[model samples]
Target: MDARAEHDSDTRAVSRAVSELARRTRFPIAFGGLAQGGAIHVSSIVGARTRSLDGLVVQETRGLGGRAFAEKRPRLALDYRTSRSITHDYDGQVLSEGIATLFAVPVLVSGRSRGVLYCGSWGQAGVGDVVARPAFAVAEELATELRVGEEVRRRLATMPPPATSDAMAPAMQEELRESFAELRSIASTVTDTAVRERLTKLEQRLAALSRPAGPAAEFDVRLSPRELDVLACAALGATNAEIAAELNLREGTVKSYLQSAMGKLEASTRHAAVAKARRAGILP
Candidate 1:
């Protein structure tokens, strides 16, 4: 389909994600697209009334979303009104929405900010790292979909079928199908409910293009930088001993990081750690 159509579909997919996140999470959810004037405005809401908060645009370098977009990573606030690290220019909107605990993650594509995803806990603060992980988890999944969809659209534009032939060649058709299939597999493998729903839609689109195969599943599990590095090594079939050799970390430290990841994923072994990490979009 066209770009607008693709964008609309993605928007709906995000809406569904917000809904699912609201249902599964204790936080209120909001997704926002960065407008032309460098303002972040809420695009969808869940666990709260959907009203027009258009007047509340998170300006660049200001507010939670702006800081997220500026920093190009996730930001958390135990209390929005009292958070001193970031600007509170959107205090009116926060008050209107009755938001307290706030977490924001920037949605990036090729190192550029495209949007922001946020979760809020009303009346209470101190969401801690527990909520932070899941919030980043959702944002990362959404970013992947946006990136993949953009890539798919670009590929389609460059290789349209001849006027006298089918809409797509057999090989192209197969590629699309395979890509979609793999996308579906990745989506299915994700344990987080919100992530699964958003990815399912992206997978459907890719499948219609071909069998749905592309890059191996690369998920961002919001592990600390060191944890991510260790997981990457583990995914390559490195033993803790080998991982220690590569990273110059003690085997006990390597094992500890692995154990922490496994615990977060509720997994039982190193193999299960990799599997669960893959499923959670923490590792490729």
Candidate 2:
């Protein structure tokens, strides 16, 4: 999708998240923004006067959302109108909406803050952990989706355009094979299962695209999911113990996966297995 469409879709998801958070947290208003440049530009809001928050911008470290964005953590203010915990740069707009208590949850992806989610009450209702917990859950879900969306856009940008004629040029065909291999490797690092599955299917479709019109290669290199997971890390030069720690598996299990992958690739050593897999378009 183009940038505007992508942002529109993300805004819809953000709307649903804020609405649910407002319902669960008993907050009268919920609003938030994705990080852009040095500020968080509020993009979605619920239960608020649109003029008060619509398109509001919070500079880094200048407001509750700013503090949370800079610190990469949650920031809270009970009685925000009179609180000194955060800068009062946005107080006029916030007070216009009669908001008192506010919570800002930073949406983190791969340990970096990408956005903020705000839950607020018009009264000094004191939103405690009871509300913050579920609000953070929604933030986590948003972070996951944003990360996948980033990956999809980044990868697809480099993909070859549709063939004008019936045939793909030889150079483009080889590039597609390499990209398919990279996609499989990328899938191994994705924490979201559905995103990983989508990447796997993309890799398969690319593999099919690279084939001749007649029957393709009879030998389809089949590797188990675990095997792919283990080798993808090993290809990055991760040690067995490191791989085990990263994958949350026992050291023995890591070794077992390595051995299985080597056997399936018909390679006698771990390095050989990695090289063989790369040649077979099983690794980037």
Candidate 3:
């Protein structure tokens, strides 16, 4: 698939998951991922627009999203109307839209907090713990899907684009450039460093794809999803212990994933694997 198409597909998947969850629950649901710049970027919204928060980004340690990312766990405010512990940078936005009850859960993959999922109510001021817990699980699934999507995109990058002689129209080419720029901007804001860096590279590749015809760029070594998962955790600067915790695997299993990733990348150490993966288009 084309880079643009891949991004659209990922977003669509997120939307579908969130929509399904929203339909089954009373509160509105929104799913988002961490951006490179350590900011939480909303990816999908599936509920009442009681607020114009479908695609909003919340900075680290600022609001509920920020707090969730900071604590690397679910953060909740029983009543948004009277939460004194959390910052209210986006409160006006919520208040204007009548979003009173709110719960935020950090999405984690490979021991790293990726982004946040939010479930909220417009009429009530308190969010039940029961709702918050299940919301976290759903967010975890969304995060996994994102990791899988990233892996697929990496694989697609390895499969060389079809041979063609014709160039795109100038207008279409410019549009691609604009789209790539926006994507890069989004990539830059992800809270996870590894995801952000990989996204940056992906953005660069897409930009290159938009350039006038040239020799196809060579791809580096590829990795399986499991290996990619391990490398992603390592790239996040997590130890095997941390990776194990994140993936719910034994530390030995984490080591095995790292070893396999290293072997694929022909790396001699964890650092080398991460470095080579980045160079090989495996780590982001």
Q: What C-alpha lDDT do the candidate models reach, one value each?
A: 0.64, 0.76, 0.64
lDDT of 3 by residue, 5-47 (tens): 8667666655655664565455754545555487877777765
Say which candidate scores most in lDDT.
Answer: 2
Alpha carbon lDDT of residue 148, candidate 2? 59
Candidate 2 residue pairs in backbone clash: none
Model 2, 108-225: lDDT tens digits are 9879988889998877876667888888878877776676567656666766765756677665665665455445554556554544565677666665664445644233568897
- Residue 267 error for model 1, in Å? 38
Instruction: For model 2, state the Cα shift of residue 99 in Å.
Output: 1.5
Between candidates 2 and 3, which one is better according to lDDT?
2
TM-score, every prediction: 0.59, 0.64, 0.51
Output the lDDT of residue 248, model 1: 72
Give lDDT for model 3: 0.64
Ranking by TM-score: 2, 1, 3
Which lDDT tens digits does candidate 1 get at residues 129-224? 666666666666666666666765665665546334435565565444334433433343356665556565554444333222344344445565
